[model samples]
Target: MSVLYALAGLLIIAAVVSLVLSLLGVIVVGALRILPVVFVVLAAVFFLSGGRIDVHLPDKWRRK
Candidate 1:
């Protein structure tokens, strides 16, 4: 639990630093760089919450 908190804190700090650096124009932040991080953060939150996302589709889409 402590480790998880520590990791989450570090991620927050890193995000803050990245935002600051982006504002400073020291580095260019683009979708390519942003997406994986967003995915990772969302996945982590979802995993910690033990939540499931269910997608419903039409029967046509379910068939090959």
Candidate 2:
């Protein structure tokens, strides 16, 4: 009887941890998927401003 109670307690704890980790994983994956879209929108905005805005790359990043 005591062993069964212990096992149940452990199962509950494991389930809670798994649920939290799954939620975090979902949030991180969503952010990563949306990042490119965010950048594209910003770039479009800059271009629509009629060359008033410019994006500069670092010296090492500049194409030869």
How high a TM-score does candidate 1 get? 0.40
Clashes within 3 Å, all models in order? 0, 0
Q: TM-score of model 2 relative to the true fold?
A: 0.60
Candidate 1, which segments miss by more than 4 Å at Cα? 26-64
Best by the lDDT measure: 2
Candidate 2 lDDT: 0.94
| Candidate 2 local lDDT, 1-64, one digit each (tens) | 9999999999999999999999999999999999999999998987888757468889999888
User: What's the distance in Å from true for residue 9, model 1?
Assistant: 0.2
RMSD of each: 18.4, 4.7
